[model samples]
Target: MNGSKISFLAFGELVVRQLTDFSNNAFAALILLIQDARTPMAVSSGGDDIMQSHES
Candidate 1:
């Protein structure tokens, strides 16, 4: 690998609305709201579950 020929990418979508609305929501407030929401909540660790990970 040649250092001079190397470049890198950080590709992803920017959530513009979320970014702008961020100022109105404090960290604690966001946490409390997420906790209170009536949806099934689970934290993802690294890759998705086993089936999806292997399929990809």
Candidate 2:
């Protein structure tokens, strides 16, 4: 029970972060943002990187 609660909290934080990060992004650009939220963040990277890579 405690583990699930902790997981829920972490998920909520990620959601808030996502919302904030995508606030200025366009609706079209938001599609990928929403899709990425469905995946486990820790596993999103190969476990070596936590931040996304940008070319610009």
Candidate 3:
């Protein structure tokens, strides 16, 4: 019982960290998209990076 509880807590913490990172990346990408709407090149690069991160 004690081992399972510890493992569950560890798993939950890992999930929360991953979610936080993903949300932060998404927010940054959104801001970049808005700020660079006029510049297709910049937007494309940031968007590509976001896609790569998503795959990872």
List the candidates' TM-scores in order: 0.23, 0.42, 0.66
On lDDT, the stronger of 2 and 3 is 3
Worst 10 residues of 2 by lDDT: 47-56
Q: 1-56 in candidate 1: lDDT tens per residue? A: 45433432211123555665675577768886687564333334333465467788
Please give, for residues 16-36, the per-residue lDDT of candidate 2 as tens digits.
989977785767577777766
Residue-level lDDT tens digits of model 3 in 1-56: 99999999999999999999999999999988888886654667778788789899
Model 3, 18: alpha-carbon shift in Å? 0.2
Best by TM-score: 3
Q: Cα lDDT of model 2 overall?
A: 0.71
- Tell me the lDDT of model 2 at 41: 60
Clashes of each: 0, 0, 0
lDDT of each: 0.52, 0.71, 0.88
| Number of colliding residue pairs in model 2 | 0
Residue 2, model 3: Cα distance from true site in angstroms: 0.2
Candidate 2: segments with Cα more than 4 A from true spot:
26-56
Q: Judging by lDDT, tell me the better candidate of 1 and 3.
A: 3
